[model samples]
Target: MRLSIIRDAFDLVTKTQNLSSSKTDEVIDQIGLEIEIALGKMHNTEPGVDCKDVLNELMRNLLRIAPLSQMEGIQNELNVPLCEYKKILEKYFNPDISKAYRNFDIDTHTLNQIISKHFYREGLFDVGDHFVSVLGEPESAAIMKSPFLEMYQMLEAMKDRNLEPALNWAATNSDKLAQSKSDIVLKLHSMQFLKILQNGSIVETIDYGRTYLSPFTSTHKDHIQMLMACLMWIGKLDQSPYKALLLPSNWERLAEELKRQFCNLLGESYNSPLSVTLAAGVQVLPTILKFTNILVKKRQSMNHLPVPIDLGCEFQFHPIFVCPVSKYPATEDNPPMFAACGDVFCKQSILMMTRNGTRVFQCPYCPLDIDAAECRQLHF
Candidate 1:
């Protein structure tokens, strides 16, 4: 059904010539043409009109087709063109105009005039008048693209206490929004727009900014604007105390622990007891020391440090040192020595000397020699 209508609308748009002036008459004539095309496409050669299907098609065409024309053409002619009035009664009340009129004692001519005035003027005042008349006053008002119009309608409707039907109708057509075509005057009247900037959903901020913040307008910095909007949205939310604790110390600690656990899982000692391989011995100490420094600095920077100064800077944060490997001597009296190429080894190059040995030792990271004396433990 949608495809059929789209094809018809395309044909209509293609065949029809552009209105040079877009005068009141031309606009009205275009509306008549649209109605004719919709009727023809929904044309039934059988017993009667498929009233339900025809009505649905007509409303969809209005919602989709009409918006395209308004978007493409100049806005001045987008006013409810005159001929649109002829079909309003047909479109709105459906096949049961008598039933509708009887139900409410509403005058059809007055309604036609109201719709005509709105279609021609395309102003908030006229739109409000038409909406109030058609939907009838229990102020369920939402400005289609115009917050000011919505607010005005809402205010006008509020004067009358009976507003349920209007509210219900407004809610029903909530999705029938036009990208608000507002001038400076309309903007001046938009209070809800300001309120939403102060407090609204993330989705709403993006949507509103598309219209209000012109793409052509240059900002001092793109990132600054983006971050500012994010900050505004974040600042408005109900924050928790724990959200502030995400610091460098916490991050570094997490990384160190993860590395330690991973090495343990790989069957490697996190803190090597036997300096059997240079790689195994090198892995744990430097990483732990670096992380300790990071945590201490971060804690001090955050002003969370107390007594027992470690770094000895103005910030008195003490670092917790990891214990040295158990098998290694505590004193530098028998410290492990490395060769000239920055390879840590003791006494000799084991890999070069061994041939029939079940186990041999070497550097894991680079081509460094290892001590043979510690390699024959063979347990690991």
Candidate 2:
């Protein structure tokens, strides 16, 4: 429920933003076109189309469109949704984020490196360079600059709807990408194929496909088939069932995929490590804030959370098998064992109860009894 409210508020703000931009651009374009036509007539080299008459007509059309009023109306259209969105935000998550803050041992050098590196990761080379020059080390920036620069260049070209740079980069790294089990190269070509086909150039699309896409046929036959299916809908592809291929997000997903694979090739993470840390911290802040007082008191004694922190599967790096019976995490010496009723407990806990397989033991959480031999050591 909390997430839904936030999502709806966010969507309202975005919707208003898109509408505002569209309406403003549309009004400006219409006004500009009117001025261009009026100017051409006012400087009438053609016969007797009165300059005064053209000026009057222009004024009438301008008045009809009412650019200023149109803009004011668009602003009014935005006010309610935006005001509601702001209210929703303040109502839901008004936490003092400072409450979750904790001091770290990071010194000047490491902090500079992180700040400078984050700038470069976002493609702000000049800012990053300046930042490093002041109090940071420029060498740290240089280490990642080359690779990230190329990635930023591809991203820029992608923004302009030019895929050649990204396609070329993907082609060059085809071997590495394939070795890493990345299908990004195929994806790049697929987008390019649709782009060419959408422009009503069948010969080029087929030629490009035959040259660049045929190789992926054996491994990605289904995807290739889906692309080929679009040939029948060519120029009218947007009206076809496969129209989703043309969404703006496809390019975004491709760009992110390219970034991920590029970083994978360079043995780096796609997200800046600092960004990852901050994101994790944000997700955990609420839980920590709830137990702030207790945590502060036992800070030295506690090695883990007072209660389990379910960070979901994405943040979980490894399998955790803490035995419920013993209330301790599993280890090599005391591995988790599954009994007949599918209940798991530490090996030592079972041993103490069954006396090293001399007798049957009942499952801790269920009524089922089992011999020690029936229990199997659980692997992560």
Candidate 3:
């Protein structure tokens, strides 16, 4: 809406300029013609043609049509649209984000360290170093250097279509990978086999598959079979049934998987904290701004917002349990309890239902009867 108003103002100014220029030209032409006619009349009569009266008449006509007063009027007309545009901007433009900042009270030093560490984790070594130097904490930069550096080096190798570094890293952390039940190693080997099939000889491809893929056959039998079938279409693999193996998306997926495994080994999250926070903010900022506007209009204090803001399931990182019996959210103090009959309720609610001089409480969801003492706390 603001843009539309500004565009209209611009168009009006342009039209006003064109109209003023044309009117000024017309006034000048009329004055010139009057002078020419007056001179012609006096040209054959006298030596000194005193055309003062004619000149005064022309000046009066020019002033009446396109004077300095009219220029001021035109400027006033342009100012109306411009003022309207400014008013619209002031109405909708919210530059105050202090409401959002009011909730956070992080330590300055901690915030700086976190930012510097984030820079290092993102492979901005020089930026991290400069930040550390500015903060007079060179040791922070030194402490954070090695781990992310190795991770990025492995990623760089993968980008270059060289998987040796990643493969070696995976082999070195095989035990931890197995404990996590991650299939990254097998997926990496599969990508390696596909690379060989795309560029190397059939003999070399078969050799590579046998050496790398055989270990994963027990868990990924069908995938291995499909990969081996690609060998039949050696040179014409694009038309083969297993052609999806050659897709660039496969490499991208492998890269993501490798990064996930790498972060898991380092006891870090798969996604950067800053990225997750920004994404969550993008999801919730609209609702927050709307609420803020409402509070402002109502002339109410916004210090406490009791209303819930739903940001959808995507932003819900952890499980949330609501008790069906109590119709309330389950918290640590009153957790969800699972009964022997497969029905769940808040602990306090279940205890209340069974405390009427009876040991057994009929399950609300099922026909089975169960004792409240038999209930167990359920964890998400």
Mark the regions of model 2 whose C-alpha exceeds 4 Å error after superposition.
Answer: 1-115, 229-236, 239-242, 295-303, 321-379
Cα lDDT tens digits, model 1, 1-380, are 53465455444443342442444355566667778876776665356767677668767766564565654554433333423433443433234222111133778755554443343223345655565567664243332224334333443453442334334433343333112221222222122233344465656755655554443236324532543344354444335232322233533443344334323433434443322234442333333343445665777332222232233342222433211222222233333434333444322233344546734455544685554555431110
TM-score between candidate 2 and the true structure: 0.59
Winner on TM-score between 2 and 3 is 3
Write candidate 3's Cα lDDT for 209-318 as tens digits. Answer: 99989988898999899999888988888898878777888878888888788888888787777777788876665556767778878996666443555668866778
Best prediction by lDDT: 2
lDDT at residue 104 of model 3 (Cα atoms): 53
Question: What is the number of backbone collisions in each predicted candidate, taken in the order shown?
Answer: 6, 0, 0
Task: Note the residue pairs that clash in candidate 2.
Answer: none
Per-residue lDDT, model 1, residue 137, is: 44
Give the whole-model CA lDDT for all candidates, comma-separated.
Answer: 0.40, 0.83, 0.79
User: Ten residues in a row with the worst lDDT in model 2?
Assistant: 300-309
Task: Write the number of the candidate with greater lDDT, choosing between 2 and 3.
Answer: 2
Model 1 backbone overlap count: 6
